[model samples]
Target: MSAIPVTIGRRAALSLDSTPVPAGSPLVDTHGRVHRDLRISLTDRCSLRCTYCMPEQGNEWLAKTSILTLDEIELIARVAAADGITTFRLTGGEPLLRTDIVEIVRRLAAIEGPDGRPVEIAMTTNGIRLPEVLPGLAAAGLGRLNISIDTLRRDRFHELTRRDRLEDVLEGIAAAAASGLRPLKLNAVAMRDVNDDELVDLVEFAIAHDAQMRFIEQMPLDAGHTWDRSRMVTQDEILGALAQRWELTPVPGRGGAPAARWTLDGGPHTVGVIASVTAPFCGDCDRLRLTADGQLRNCLFSTTEYDLLPILRGTSGEWEQDIDGMLRACVRGKLPGHAINDPSFLQPARGMNAIGG
Candidate 1:
């Protein structure tokens, strides 16, 4: 509420001036993968320079000219809505960093749903700037939020994230709970020796606030290619640790949730673990991600991407139809699962931030 956070950008780029994809182009692609859920990155700039994603003060941010405008995002959402996507989420280097984020929420929320209701809207934030946007966003059609808070320790938090906002995020979590953001989930990327010890502490932290916590397996999503299996906190170790610390039991939840559901001994809140590495859920993968720059990534683990901006800007708008055709082409290689741990595997060139992580 003090003031909006500064969105990272040198200046407005020409990339935001592109035309929208036309209608009747069949937004649906081959594998029957209708545009069910769309993850839109507001910007590819994050405040936290995590060891996995960004090196300490050593990274290149995307130029302002290369990012999409709110209008561009609205147009894309509308077209994707026409195709079939009913759910939408705002992501970013940190979506909250984008000062115009609240307006973006309102714009995307205005997108008409299949049943004529506003689209189901949500955001994935780092919680640093959530306090500022929480009120405006909730009023704009945001249904829920997923905040990334990897560690509970203030010192370790600074060490891992290279940011100075542990208490700030904690306050945001409290504010989020009071704001009626039901099913608020804390996303924790489990890393051995970094924050793995906080797994139980995180669950306890969430329970006290009546919030759910999800421990996600660290995958190869960073830029430096520093992902190591030895450093990974596997699903087995997570469950084993929980079993030792608490009387854990399985709890039922959504089908497509990346987390393997579980509950504490006798707590009011639920804690989940997203076994992306030890247990990949590509079989039920029913989502798609569209980058802010107009590239379509069919699978997060796949390096292949289809550039859609060129097609969208062509004179006849024939690119509209090509968007559909391109999607169909992507299905041919939707990759049932990711081989991130394989020694022969190579991570996608783009960092997690670039890919709407």
Candidate 2:
């Protein structure tokens, strides 16, 4: 495959050596936020087609040659780890779709973080194939898991995902629990009149399975760009639904984490809400995403992307330096916020599935 032109701008001219980024050097943006979490998309292919993520068909996937190889991914990750990135979340259209998922996990788990420890590795997957990959992933040093199941009802799941694989997802969840992947999180996109009614049931199911449930406010990241704010189930609405069944007390100390957690009734098992729209957490954002095709995205909603594929595939003697510079440049260029609520906010061309939810 021919090399794609690098899209890095003049701002990336700042050299890593000149900056002298030491271990744990806060990859600070202009907003005074330190970025340490790196979310990597293993592939742009998935097993299910959720209406909010993508259409049922006619989805264009990244080419095999265009996707980053396991080696290339490790190289970038190693650089990120050395530069203070301590947490890595492997996401995808469905990460399990990658044939080298286990090897990918093992490679990442082997990388040493800024503190000289093996960097923490986690994955967010639609639980359809979790049952088959759980043992391999666990053994590969996976630290945590977040499984997406929007609805507990089989029929409802089919309606939302355009697939009748709720049974597979449930089995996968059970398998993950059995494998002792503790602090397991179940993610549900709370859509008004869709799965909003199942909020309480989902949390109860999570508690029974020794997992925490997180309900996410639907953002305008759908493939069709058909997200209507009026139709979205807000954080307050989700809280209201939960309050009807149980008393929720706020859990303190939610730092850069996306979810604002609340313990149910009193103590122990808790529920969370990722209010990306109603209550944006951009001020505390600490994530940077690397697309499956090797594009670096500082903000999930950012209109800008810096291409890393060219440098990765180039025979240019300064691969490491170039990548490090590009990475820093990307972070340095991060916007103060996604600006999703503002009138000037424009939805990105790519949807959630393409962007690696």
Candidate 3:
């Protein structure tokens, strides 16, 4: 496969005389948000071509050599873990598509955090292949799972994903639940006049499956760049729809989590809304994304990307120190918010799949 040429509007320029990061320093940005979550994209390949993610064809993928090797991923993850990164969320076009995913999880799970505990490893997958991989992943210390399912209706699923694999997704969800992945999450992107009407149904399905449902407001992260604000469902609308079906009591203590959760009918079952477009949780954001091709992204909507592949593959003896300095530099440059609602806001060059979910 040929490497796709990415047009990065901003690139982090590494200085030769950059100061070394202080020992045991926490990854904190200018806004004082302590970074910990590391979302790593293992690949840009997916089994399904969802309308909101990418087109069916004409999309160039990264060459195998350009993609980070497992060894490289481990080295970067270890550095982050030592720097106080406690959570690792493995994401991708579909992480299950990686042939060595289980081993990747195992290597990551072995890395201890600053506090001397193994870092938490989670994954966001489309779940088509989860049924086959869930067992090995669970055994390899995969802590949590988030499965994306847009609609409950079979026809709608096909319409949205451009694939007829709703049955496989459901099976994957069932397997995940059976594998004892506690607090299993189901992610559904709520679109206006699309899957918006099924908000209640989605929640009900989640409750029945013993999983928490999260409705996400569609942002301008689609590969097509065709995201329309008018067509995107807002958080308030989702809550309002659920309110008609059941009373939703707000759940407290949502620190750094993208989802603002509420208990349905004041008990047990809960539903969350990740209103990335309307609510904008960048203030509490602690995420740092490593693209499949090894670019470090400070913010989801950031136009800037720090290329770490060169440093990782450099013949220089000070690669570790160089990486540490780059990590610090990346965090220091994080924007306060995604600014998607601002008039000057420009959507990122890469879409959600390439950026990781």
Candidate 3 on 311-331: residue-level lDDT in tens? 888766455566767788888
Model 1 ranges off by over 4 Å: 1-35, 266-268, 318-322, 341-343
Model 2, span 234-254: residue lDDT tens: 999999989998889999899
Clashes of each: 1, 0, 0
Query: Which RMSD does model 1 reach against the true structure?
Result: 7.2
**Candidate 2, lDDT over the whole model:** 0.87
TM-score of each: 0.87, 0.94, 0.94
Superior by TM-score: candidate 1 or candidate 3: 3
Q: After superposition, how far is residue 131 of candidate 1 from its true place, in Å?
A: 1.4
Over 4 Å off in model 2, which ranges? 1-24
Q: Candidate 2 at 187: error in angstroms? A: 0.3
Q: Which ten residues in a row have the lowest lDDT in candidate 3?
A: 1-10
